[model samples]
Target chain A: MKIAVLSGKGGTGKTLLSVNMAVIGENTTYIDCDVEEPNGHLFLKPKEVIKEKVAVKIPVVDMGLCNGCQKCVEFCKFNALAYINNKLMVFDNICHSCGGCVLVCPEKALTEKDKIIGEVQKGVSQGINVLSGILNIGEASGIPIIDKLLGEEPKNSQKTIIDCPPGSACIVMESIKDADYCVLIAEPTVFGVHNLSMVYELVKLFNKPHSVILNKCLDGKNPAEEFCIENNIKILDKIPFDSELGTLNSNALIAARESPKYKKMFSEIFKKIIEEAQHEAAVNP
Target chain B: MKIAIPVNDKSLENGVCQSFGRAPYFLIHDIESKENTFLNNSAALSRGGAGVKAAQMIADNEVDALLTPRCGDNAAGILKVAKIKLYKTEGDSIEDNIKAFNEGKLSPLMDIHPGLHDHGGR
Candidate 1:
């Protein structure tokens, strides 16, 4: 079974929840899909990881075979190809790597070249296998890296927990597409409520079985609780804000490692997810 | 000769729009006939390539010159390829900028600005 952990906005404790659950969850394999700023590793501290560079196919123009027809320039929707000062200028940041330029080139001047955009690391953390993709800075988007990671996911019998990036973008969609269940980590703030609704809409559009895990549930009823109740969305677990856990999180340590309470909570959360997933499978089947 | 001016409104009084790509409308004034017409800058609604689309619109109109506060590199490339002389906005009012163009007071725009990622304009 595959479970994806995501949030509408960043700093909503997605990594915290995912990393803790992955460490305590039974026979779990964790994959961090947030290529832009993956921090799950900071907590997991996996050892003896194998690293591989992630590359995207960017267009390379063979000027010798070229006529200055500007056909490729006209075909690019991103305006990444430009005919400037009697030469072709490529804005790689704007390029979506669609390879339309290669096909539209009447002069046969375009060829695809691999450009390294990120790296993926495979490691083992406390008997749990972890895979992560990290995008190079100023790469415009992390969708390509995320796509590559998901496309090449290691096949295993272990229960998979995918840690997705913030926002309901193409990258986020790519992460949750194959998930059997989605765990949306949300806070109790105003922005949290707004973004949670937006992400929930996307998850619902995908028709995936999803539930909310309200992180840092404060002293009283917050906006997240009210929104979830009104929408009839299930609240899987409510992990209260703890100062000691915050300190451990700040130090890049998983709270479950030092505290028995967090360990039991993570285990319970994992068990609840499994039970719900199995129940849904049985009913849907 | 004809010129294009990015405008806040279709009228002559409104100041030139700050960015070229996402301008609301372009005021095309024909120097020979002393006649003016407004063309909606449809590129303003595009998610991407607004600069390229706007440049193509102005170029297709056969404008001799373009006046704007800023032109992104992509738009500048298209305008240059079309052989349209790009001029910097000399004043807030389109009427004044047109007068400055007639007097040869406005300098040609050369510095290329960065692309505005969104439809929001100046």
Candidate 2:
């Protein structure tokens, strides 16, 4: 079963929760889909990393084919192609990798070329297979890297934990596309409730079974908790706002592996998720 | 010499459009003929690369120079290749900018900003 951990914004403990749960779960494969800025490797600290470059197919023009037809330029909705001074000019960043230009070329002047945008690293950490996607700076989109990260993973009996990027954008949707269950990590503040609602709406729109895990719980009123209760969303677990957990996380250490307390905490959350997932399958399937 | 200026309205009485790529209309004024013509900017509604498309439109008109408040790097690159000089507008008035251009008062627009791409999604 693939369990996706995501939030509306950063600093909501997505990496912390996913890394902890992956450490406690048996036969777990942790895949970090946050290509823009992946930090799961810092905590997991995988060994013998194997890096593979990820690329997207972009159109390259061969001006020697002799036709100055503006067909490719007019066909491109992104306006990535332009004909100026009896020559065709292509903008790399503006191109969306749509092969229409190549397909529409009557003279076959346009052909697809690989443009490396990012890399994917695969390694092992404490018996768990850890994979991270790292996008190059200044790249427009990280969807290609996420596609490589999740697309190549084998579908097996192992419990896959997908750590998604922040927000309810296309990247987050791509990360959770194959998830059996989504774990929404939310803080306790009012702003946290707003962010939670965004992912809440996104998961609901995707028709995926999901639950909320409240992070940084304190003594006072928790707005996120209230929002979940009103929405009838399942409350998986609540992690207290403690300095011990913060220190471990800041030190780039997996709290579940270092402390027995965090291990038990994440273990319980993992168990509850398994049970909920099983119930969802039984009911839906 | 012909000059292209992004404008808000078809008339010359209005101010220059603050945005070049998304401007509704472009007023092409010819100094040799002492004539003015307004052409609708088709690149105004482009999903992306509006600046490049707008620059291509201006270049296609055979304009010698572009007078605007600002320009994007992608548009500037296209204009540079097209041999179109970019003169920074002193103010919003189209007539005033045209007069300044005739009098050679406007300076070259050196500060070209990076285009705003994918802002619609954010």
- Positional deviation of A219 in candidate 1, in angstroms? 2.9
> Could you give the C-alpha RMSD of every candidate to the true structure, in order shown?
3.5, 2.4
Off by over 4 Å in 2: A154-157, B9-14, B32-35, B118-122
**lDDT of model 2 at residue A45?**
91
10 residues in a row with least lDDT, candidate 1 chain A:
A82-91
Which is the leading candidate under DockQ?
2
Residue-pair clashes, model 2: 0
- Candidate 2, residues A135-166, lDDT tens digits: the string is 88766689999989997675653788999999
Real interface contacts reproduced by model 1, as a fraction:
0.24
Instruction: Report the lDDT of model 1 for residue B45.
Output: 81
Q: Model 1 - which docking category? A: acceptable
Candidate 1's displacement at residue A97, Å, is 1.8
